[model samples]
Target chain A: MFQSDEDRILTLITRKLMGEATSSELEELSLLIADNPSYEILIQSLTHIWNTSPARDEDFLEATFLAHIDRMKKNGCDFDTYEQEIEAKRPWYSSRKLLVPVFSLLAVVAAFFFWPRQASVNTPVIIAEKEIKNEISTRNGNRTRIQLLDGSTVWLNAGSKLDYGKDFGGAKREVYLTGEAFFDVAKNPEKPFIIHTNAIDVKVIGTQFNVRCYPTDKMVETSLIKGSVEVLVKNRGEKWVLRPNEKLLVENISYQPLKKERNVAEPVRARKVFVAIKPLTYQNNDSVSVEAAWVKNWLSFKDESFAEVAQKMERWFDVEFEFRNESVKELSMYGTFTSESLQQALEALEFSFGFKYAIQGKKVIIY
Target chain B: MAAYKKLFHCLFPSIQNFAFSIVKSRQLAEEIASDVLMEVWVRRLKLMEVANLRLYLFTSAKNASLKKLKQENRFSPFSLDELQVEFISDYGNPEEILNGSELEKKVQEAINELPTRCKIIYKLAKEDKLRYSEIAELLEISVKTIDNQLVIANKKIISAIKYFVRKKS
Candidate 1:
């Protein structure tokens, strides 16, 4: 790579800031700055920026530590054993018991109120409240299994959030979902498990199914793995029962306003939703249905366009895809990726689809 | 145990921030940080054989955060590029040195606008005080890449400062 002198000086200055620059490199950097008096201010400012450290909130950290200790004790961590071990190693004069009073005082202080003092520029203050709303979320490239108090399990896919009130499983077993999740409802016929999404509300007595209702997706999908499920489209108030191994697709009517503008002549048609019931997708010789493969950690897709697959991959791998070639997005892709690195998955796609792709930092550009 | 508390005070913030970059949730990050530190105490005898305790803790934090995401059933691979790191650069002394808060805001925005990979590299090098070789090893990138990313970050900050200087003159 051809390096510019300015870039070279900046690199040397960075190395110096990180304490990685050799004496010769330091001399070279100084000489470069001396030659160009204009560079002095830049170098100084950069150095100052490098040396500057964020202010720490001692009070907040102390409160957090106290809370952490409380949680550890709740989780059955034997701090007394560790304390005895430490006491055996050290003399009584140097015992940790000396600081025990200070910690107790701090805990007393924290009990009144502990507000986060160190507020960063962009981070919003998250109030750590135990009651009110209980929310669990997973970021992209991650999945999590959550067990509710009702003995039901939910496998939350990436880029998903499940929110429930504190009264959950009390009067009604209801949850609001913003992305995709697989649910195994406990056998509670008295309390129907209901999931409220933007497009539809799924009600079930005791069943196993997957609900995908991402805000950006065109259709809300409900794939039943076993048992039965009842779905109600919010707009039309239409209800349908889903049997085992059946998938229901309901057009996301939230996008109707945008579509209404494009088809003003068919106003009645615009208000209607396209509903379809089909068998669950399965790859040849594979026991796992493609719809539920994500629960098993398999990124499976069958006859989905590259654009659609890219969206899934975005959540699956946490990388944004930019298609430079429009025609390539329409190419149909079929495969299952299990435990493959992002680069490896991309390479496999490139080989199969005959498209060139570049993996930048968190961005995958395809042509 | 006192030594352990001291270690917790020393390493908690950075580890929590590192976990926060990956999980993008404050509560989860805190849990992961606490879990990582607690593991050190639980497995102290076994961990004695491990070299580079700081790096080990960092690696543990990273894995713990990712593990929170994938859970037991999934086998998704993670890349550092996916991390949306929140770089907190101090504006206390630098504000007076840079002349005004406006320039400080500009510098802050510039730091914020740096590429995610660049931000992580710069943070690991400068804030976390990790060596270039250590950062390279942790991120699975070459030392030269870390060097280049730092330069890019410094260049961006310099340009932001230069813009303010130019506007004044």
Candidate 2:
């Protein structure tokens, strides 16, 4: 883009210094400045140079001054007091104190520019207290459904234990959940309903959803069926939230936890899940059920991980499962069964996944 | 400072942001900031023609805050805890959700302190409902710059929010 030596060089330098140069322009300028100290001085001098016929020092200074004005105009920046002080030190310095006001104007512009902003007082304070005194356990053959005091609905999947609800408090609303549960919350503004799993705190005001939070699986999955919810969990320190229809699977889970997996996480000292609200597809029916299968006392799955289904199976049958080939973790199934038969469901699963099994009372074994 | 009173009120809703970061003590913050306001009245001339009083107040507030902390250091050492309140409602009051408009306003103000380019870009994209290409043309830049600006802007905003939260914690 250069034509002459001095004028072309100065023009390019001015553009580059003002941050208007494109990537290639910037690269060329950088390369030139890198090998040549004189070039760097020349560029800086452009700001100090005068722009007049034969360009006297005063005129050159005025031209440079005009360039700064135009660049700032394009940039919409005003003068600061320091610059005003400098100009005040000049023959035309009176024009510079106006610089402070202008800089103040620029500060208004900067207010619109800087990151440290004056944001309103209503930043939503996320408060979580997941202290539930109960050590809940589920049996393999039964389904448990509970209506939380907040009007949120939860269906405890079979064989899964959810430690929840002593009560809700003003600054915080929380429940410690383990294994799996489907949730339907009643909307509330003043307080947010939260579920603290071993890894995250799932939050909502009023929304219908299901969270399969068993650590046994490779991931913790949350499925939203209605309304909106925010999943706030500390990921290293930052929290996150999930919106409706979006399913989040935390894939960083340890495989051993999914093994004879008793309690997935420590039940305390974990992160919060974070999700955001987005536009949603309107529901066709207001009566949509998040726990349609288990609410009616049945273990239901149209297509879900077999291990997840097995976790439900363990809860319903109140049994422990010992898998011979840990590879059985890959198989998934979709089927629903009433509490009518944990034995039949296991028999069907054994037949489909192609594994050997034995039932020693409540414990099921496959080798 | 008298000239700033109106702007101060407008900035007041947002001052908690700077105050939280500086004071480190809410009671001391509220008190000193009020003192700062009185000082604004007492030394109006020195502050007169102060271009960005938001910046000035913030700097003054911050200096006053540092002084207060130093004074507290002259006293005893201590630690406090969360003011745990009983659940006003077992879950939460259903009525809070019904009142949605207030939350939206709060969300908007929180969006304000973003970088100017980011502010313009976000407002153009969100409020005036412009396309990226349209924004690029108006600003004479690349659409990608606008996107990057948003990421940076979101980071600053998110941190400010967390700063407020951690102050209480």
Candidate 3:
């Protein structure tokens, strides 16, 4: 046989890798490997590449579902109902919630144990169906305007995502928000627009309000520009109504991971949702409200700690910050930046706060 | 719609990546894939009668991607007779194989560098795991074309791996 015949044998081995080779082809492959010796190495190399290829990884599943849900929503198709239909039909996928996370955790632990061993069990064959919802996410230093079907306009802040189902505006208009958004809801007496966040649920009827509820932030704020919105605090079931130009700051006490004991799963401490309604701060000679400054592409903070400011800066500039000293986190700062480069912003902060910061690529190390 | 979602979750990545290999843009590939899967959903009643679901999806993705290419004025028409396989001397370095992530990336880049049709064939056979006959049936080409494309793809992958190894050394 010629060199080209050996290539043909390798192609047969490729067929074997894909479970497409016949018994005769397998026998031919074995014969070729025995004869050439080089064919064995070729098969092993190719198989290894095939098995561990990145294309086999399921990282795009979440993204694909998001995009699919967006497409489905455009067609007036309800994804939630579609999902429910699938769940109702498939008995095998019934216990997916409990089974999937456990399997994923095991897969993670197994990956750690078998990292060097190159175990084939690294990939799990679990098909978990997470609820598909339409999601729009904005990165740091970026803002977006989303116009809903109900003629409501939402100005989404940097590093925010607004998720709503296809059933939005049909019955009860509700949207799940992370980070922050300024909602200018259309007047609808029958259907009240509701915004669900980690901290509180803001229900509005023809209202314009800015809700800041970053998961990492300590407080969830609902700053009303005009009209009224009823805010319901989670875990406590306490409700507070906010008037125009009034900001309702609710302490995000529901998700206190540290309050829970290390071994215990449920938190034993009595969580309290503290509510405080205050007039919106008019800054820069009453030209801008501090809470709504971000909507105008201006970064503003009042009496916020360095840690809080660092979080805001992270979103504002899309740069990661690391405080070398813990004391650096506690330093108090109140400042507003409008159209300043990240370096200039940091320089202003450093001059006033008397701290040193070094920019290393996309990271800032503060001392 | 239910069956479409099930089939979608199962095979989306393969279809999307296959489209990506052709379009060279993730966003366009995703759009093409979404369009193809949406068509499946729209025609769910008729899909059951189709002989092969995987072949149908891959074919749809390929056509949609090609159509998108033509619209974008990036379409360069060439025949399969123009294909010339290049062979590389094997370094077969152990160091190259051990770094899984880097090697996987190099392999993906290699697959990415193949001529459009050959890349799609390689992805179908290797990534999507479609059979030679299935690929031929989907592309409406002969089994010999599939074989030739796969051979070209394999040679290119080996060449890429060796190139990475040589660059590293």
Best-matching candidate per DockQ: 1
Highest lDDT model number: 1
Predicted structure 3: lDDT: 0.67
lDDT for each residue of candidate 1 in A1-367, tens digit (9 for 90 to 100): 2247788888888877776778799779877876876887787677666655566667777898888788778878887776676447542223233333222222212211121232112222132334444888889988888778788888888999999878887899999998899998998999999999988999999989999988767788999987799999877789999977789999876543333225433443358788999878764323468899888677888779998999999998999988889988987766776666788677656534456789999999997
Worst 10 residues of 2 chain A by lDDT: A47-56
lDDT of 2 by residue, A135-225 (tens): 4555555456665555666667655776654555446667777667777677887788888776566888878777766655555666676
Where does the lowest 10-residue lDDT sum fall in candidate 3 chain B?
B83-92
lDDT of 3 by residue, A1-367 (tens): 5877767776786666655667688668767766876455455566666544232223446566777878867977654655565456542222333233222222222111111222121121121234344787889877777777778888888889999877776787999998899888999988989999887889988988899987666678999987799999875788889876789998765444323223443442365657798878753122347788777566777667888788888998899888887787887666666666788677656544446789998899998
**Among all windows of ten consecutive residues in candidate 2 chain B, which has the lowest summed lDDT?**
B83-92
Q: Give DockQ per model, in order.
A: 0.16, 0.03, 0.05
Docking class of 3: incorrect
- Model 1 chain A scores worst on lDDT over the 10 consecutive residues at A107-116
lDDT of 3 by residue, B33-140 (tens): 888887766664344455565667777887887788899998865233232322111122234344655765676677667886786667666545566787787667
C-alpha root-mean-square deviation, candidate 1? 28.0
How does residue A141 of candidate 2 score in lDDT? 55
